[model samples]
Target: MNAIQFGEPVSGKTVSARVSPAGGLDILSRNEVARLRDASGSGLHQLLRRCALAVLTSGNLSDEPGTIFEQYPDFDIQVLQEDRGIKIELKNAPEQAFVDGRIIRGINELLVAVVRDIVYISTQLESGGFDLDETVGITHAVFEILRNSRILRPQVDPNLVVCWGGHSISRDEYEYTKRVGYQLGLRGMDICTGCGPGAMKGPMKGATIAHAKQRRKGNRYIGITEPGIIAAESPNPIVNNLVIMPDIEKRLEAFVRLGHGIIVFPGGVGTAEEILYMLGLLLLPQNQEIPFPLIFTGPQQSAAYFEQIDRFLRLCLGDEVSRHYRIIIDDPAAVAHAMVSGIDKVRNHRLDNKDAFFFNWALDIPLPFQQPFRPTHEAMASLALHRDRPRHELAADLRRAFSGIVAGNVKEDGVRAIAEHGPFVIDGEADVMRALDDLLKAFVAQHRMKLPGGTAYEPCYVVRT
Candidate 1:
């Protein structure tokens, strides 16, 4: 397939000239620009460079963060201050982000987002204005970060649907995701995803076509991701708005807070982690009365896959786990209809409770779930994945275990930890460990753990009973 390149008019040759900020990012203080240019050990320039590289290399599908650094070892981006605004000078930038020496408009927008988010977070940290302690403080930080990104739009009804799935999936499954996305779009619902390929990109692609047919204006294709996973799963070109949260925990929080409903596709450990997170949240007694739409769907060929997921949920979280999500197979129209009808209930619930339509402020998220879990060897081993605890607590720990596995598979830090040490050792109750082992073995057998036709996936986890 030919590359989809868009240009904003320039000379015959690709431009190698420096450019200034277009709209939102202009007129930074001299101190801020200096900090951005600093590459020394104490500077924030390294973070800026990494994020900018990820945005410039947008269409590259490999999920490896280190590869970008290796390929462009000397790549450096500096912020330049001028009389009118700020200019970004790229050193060893990717050629693909430019056409006739001009950066593509959408990529430029994303690049601006990269700068905006990194700078905003850095300033917040430097100022010591962000509270990292206490549940309310952490949630406030999340809200601030999102609000700074301009993602929180008030007065809009709940219509954002978050799609969670693996970057690695079968072609048939990917196409099925597009079908579901098309149906959802026809109903005027927008999409948000992890912004990778496979199922992540499929829905956005489908929604664009549907939106075009319906003559919809200002349709949103939002992509929420973190730095660790962005390199491997580069933002697909279809994502018009992109926001990089600080970590995976914040990223997940952004999803639940911003989206009105969720549609999960066929995925591996990452998808499982997402499911467990939502279940853990909804199972809390406070959130029991709240209405949230969740559906597990795929083509008919994926029936057995859903069955395995359903069985695992029943075995681990109990029979009542089935009440939170519905399984719809081989019917995109039915899936969309379910979401439309279900999201209506969600709207009614929010109105009845007088909750904000833009964000789910009432959901109770424990501090453990809100805190970022660094998947170190010791940390992974220390997870309390037993059944003696309350069902919700157990579910949270189970989610953490799977989250570590996902990190081992894709995230750069997690991959390095697995490489340095051995597989993460998970010891839990006998039944829980056995169930975990069975589920992981199935994922490996079905090749859901790795990118299609790429390297074979070896388990990075050792389940002990």
Candidate 2:
């Protein structure tokens, strides 16, 4: 691994280097090599470039995917296979990803992960290895992705807690997430998050300290992400296991399947989408007996945030939906204790059912929830957000509405669609629409939905009542 001292004219902080992958993959077939090197419209080079750049500039808070590419227009990476292994060649890469003259090991592993996942998914799709047309096929695809990443631990118990929340959460909320994480870690639970900043990062950060104090070894801090959202929310430094799913739906499914329990911190539409997705599944009659522990928590200052979420959830799904989760504000220890107890139940249930400790095979995720939701204007307007339908179905559409707004707010395609087509119009029942509007407005008011830099938060969709 060698580095050139001179920086590109476009950026002074950038450098060119040849570095070997720390982990993930060592070699690729002749066909895979061509697919990666091909920069044409049909190739994977552009996607590789995007994800690799995000890895090179890890921990950047900005969610603007366009701005990053614009900032480093000359940056490029190539996968070169040698007789022994492969070497990653970089041009105009972010220097922060390097230490002195060498690429950071973690960043290198993440870059390898980018190459590995992109190649795996693309290869599977082309070879018809994934059957996305049906429900079981989708779940199988998710399992295969995780298995290839090698993050699953069959020998381990049910102790991974999936944490969800807004990446741009407030300082108080961020600290609260850490507190919750610390308590969970002290009790021997590992963490998995979206692998970005804010709430996604806090739990992992807190757990590191607790794990050290407990002298725990082989602790897993896994970060699950999708390509579209990767630039907006780069994998945080704490993530030792990074797995990139093909899309958001697969990523969400990965979370539910991999973790025994989940804790939701205060967040924006993205968090809401996660909540709705989980509730929609739990509300299913088939999932009624499943004992997945879900807790919503924040500091005292953020109690109102949960309250608003609770209100909106009840109005949208029904009061009975509350049975699946519990809210514990200003109590990190209590939240952690609850999660521990809940996971014990999960362990016993899994043991009785002869299920795998690493994956939840019993969770019945329908095809609708597993399918990729393109937040196009027409798609957004087509979502049925009213409560006249079944609660799970409504939850699914409501999740889509929030997901579209999320896409518009962060994902490159969603952002471009919004810019070209204007904000999406979300027409639903009067009361439900009003409730959603109020909840979103509150999020904006509380600064949960922070925009790039100082740009004020703007609505990406109009909730028509």
> How would you encode candidate 2's per-residue C-alpha lDDT over 1-465 as one tens digit per residue?
011111122233788999988977968998998899999999999999999998877866467766678778899999997888888899999878887989988888889899999998999999999999999999999999999999988888899999999887767787888988999999999999999888888999899999999999999999999988898888888899999998889999999999999999988889999999999999999999999999999988888888889999898888998989999999999999999999999999999999999999999999999989888888989888778899999999999998988888888888888888899999989999999889988877776665435577778889886
lDDT of 1 by residue, 1-465 (tens): 111122121112223457666556766777788888888888878878888887777766455548767766767788888776778888767777787888888888888888888888778879986887777877788889888888888888888999988777777888899999999999999999998777888899899999999999889899998877777777887888888888888899989988999999988999999999999999899899988899999988889889999998888889998999999999999999999998899899989989998888988888989999988889989988777788899889999999999899878788888899989999888888888888899888777787644476678889996
TM-score of each: 0.94, 0.97
Best by TM-score: 2
Model 1 misplaced regions, further than 4 Å = 1-17
RMSD of each predicted structure: 3.6, 4.5
The prediction achieving the highest lDDT against the true structure is: 2
